[model samples]
Target chain A: MAFKAGVITFPGSNCDRDMAVALEAVSGEKAIRIWHGDADLPDGLDFIALPGGFSYGDYLRSGAMAANSPIMRAVVAAADRGVPVLGVCNGFQVLTESGLLPGALMRNAGQTFVCRTVPLSVENASSLFTQSFAQGETVRVPVAHHDGNYFADEATLDTLEGEGRVAFRYAEPVNGSRRDIAGILSENGRVLGMMPHPERAIAPAAHPSLGGEDGKRLFESVIGSLVSA
Target chain B: MKVRILVRLKPGVLDPQGRAVHHSLEGMGFDGVDDVRIGRMIEMDVADDTTDEALNTMCEKLLANMVIEDFAIEKLDNEKAPA
Candidate 1:
């Protein structure tokens, strides 16, 4: 059977199509499109993706409104069942807002919207989402967001670091994320939330300065891990 | 009843927006201002019979994110309505 992947779309979600395209390109299967208002997800989904975008106009707070949407209840339930879930950029904000991931993405310490390709250090490559990355290796991914600064209490930070939950870290400071942390995996390591837009980097760009196949490798990693298991 | 919720970032959390506003104030030559921290105020008219639990629930569940922010609720006597 083909790999079953579902990419969720929330209102104002601009990257939903891109995410679906990336998933399909790597999985060799049509990606399912799920809406935020739907109370239930389609059954037998092998993977779930929350694409990046300013859902709800980023009102009240980034990802605050979208987290409370009906579909999120189902997403949370699905995640609890060990489904591999990946959230990128605004999707990372949504995951933190929904309590599926720890810490909150705040306004960039520079107080400006940053859009560019930045290098990230693969902190934990053994997880479901990052199996393709080698630990301590650097991969360039495009990040575009205003509220990408990640914050967590000191104790929680210790716990996350101790548990090897930090999946990715900014190789250089692009935002004000503490410890330059760019992405993290859930306690069970099935869910990943990151500020970089991997979907945007799936294709090798014409220029080396631009992103490359790192994103495709991420999706391929998920597919490879699941198919082999 | 008229309700107001003030959501502010916790003291220790970094407030980039607030810091920017403070920088702007400094640029404007406002020497009297010691510090500035921006917050949000949300006003709503709920039923007179609304309970405190319900109000807090709304803040905790949706209005304010407990992870990085704190919220305070105030109920006005209606005559002092917000202009």
Candidate 2:
């Protein structure tokens, strides 16, 4: 059977098409486009992606409004059912706002929008998303956000690290994320949230200098692992 | 009835918008400004019988993000609707 991936498009979602194209290019199956107002996700989905964009025009906080959208109820339910869910950039904000992930992405400590390619080290390669990278390996991904600073209390930070839930960390300080955390995985490792845009790395030419197809391995790892299971 | 809602960022949370405005004020020759914090005010019209609980629910559910914002509700008499 073909791997079926779904990408959600909220009203202001700008990356839904990019996410869908990337998913199809990587998985060889057309990605199902789900609308935010809908109350249900497509059936028999292999994976779900919440793409990044200015959902609800970033009102009442970046993702606060979108988190309460009608479709999010279904997304939360799917997440609970162990469906592999990936939230990128603003999607990460939505996930945290919806209580799917821990902590919050606040304004950048430097008080400016951060838009640049950042080096990230794989912290836990055991998760479904990071299996492509050797543990401690550094990969470059572009991050663009006004509120990418990750904040959580010390205890929550300790829990995430002790439980091996941190999937990626910044090799250098791009945003003031707690302990330089860049990505994280859910307790069951079925959900991953990150501020960097991995979909931008689909092509070898995507990276101007590195020119290495590092991100292709991420999609391959997830789909291949699912197929084998 | 007229209702006014004040939404504020929770303590310990950084307010970048507020800080930016503060910087702008300093640039305008306003010195000695101790601090600046930004908040939102939302005004709405409701029935006279609207209880405080209902207004609180509206704030909790939509007007404010409890994680980062706290909201207070005040009802003003109809004649006080900003002239």
Candidate 3:
């Protein structure tokens, strides 16, 4: 069975096309583009993606306005139903603002927009999102964002780490994220929120160094697992 | 009534912007500056009938991000206060 994936597009979303293309290339299935205003989602969606961009012009706060958009209600419901969801960059901020994720992404400690391919270590390989990676293995992906610094209280951080909900950790200080957290998974491991742009790195040419094809495995793993399920 | 909301980063959190500004101030030869921190002030004019609860609600909802920042609401000009 061909896997069906859905990509959500907000008004200011610039990476929606790239995300759709990456999903299509990896799964051989055309991605269903969903608008932010709609309340319903396409049926039989194996996965959902929230692409990175300055949604709602970063008004009030980054991702704060988009998190309250109409379509996000459906996205939240789908996530609660165990359908896999991936949120990248601004999408991660949206997830946090929507209360799907534990904490908020703050401005970088460097107070500068960071854009580069940084090394990330796989923290939990059991999640559907990070199953393609080996624990402690470093992978390269480009991260671009001003508010990517992840912040959570100490107790919440401890809980996330103890529950193996942490999906990825920065190999080095990339955005001043707490504990160098680069990616996080929902308690059920169905929802993933990360700052790096994996869709941008789907092609081998996206990152010349490290001869990286690591990002392709992420899409492949989800699609392959969905097909088998 | 005019309400002023001061939103500031929580203590212990790194403030690179504040640090940069501090460095610049020191370079300009300002003494006894001690330290510097950056914050934003949102001033709004609301009707006299607006209650404090309403103002707090606005601060909680959008005027501040409670995670890394703290916000204090000040009643700048009230009906009984100076014009």
Candidate 3, pairs of clashing residues: none
For model 1, residues A66-165, the per-residue Cα lDDT tens digits are 9999999999999999988999988999999999999999999998899999999999999988889898999998999999999999988889999999
Ranking by TM-score: 1, 2, 3
Q: Write the per-residue lDDT of candidate 2 for residues A27-59, one digit (tens) a residue.
A: 788999999999988889889999999998898
Question: Of models 1 and 2, which has the larger TM-score?
Answer: 1
Clashes of each: 0, 0, 0
Worst 10 residues of 1 chain A by lDDT: A202-211
The residue pairs that clash in candidate 1, if any, are: none
Error of 1 at B16 (Å): 1.0
Residue B8 in candidate 3, Cα distance off native in Å:
2.2
Which digits, one per residue and each the tens of the lDDT, describe model 3 over residues A63-118?
Answer: 98788889999999999999899999999998988888898898888889999889
User: What's the TM-score of chain B for every model shown?
Assistant: 0.95, 0.91, 0.85
* Model 3 alpha-carbon drift over 4 Å, by segment: B45-51, B76-83
* Per-residue lDDT of model 2, residues B7-68, tens digit only: 99888777777888899999999999977988999999888898888899888867886766
> Which residue runs does candidate 1 get wrong by more than 4 Å?
none
Tell me the whole-model lDDT of each prediction, alpha carbons only.
0.92, 0.86, 0.87
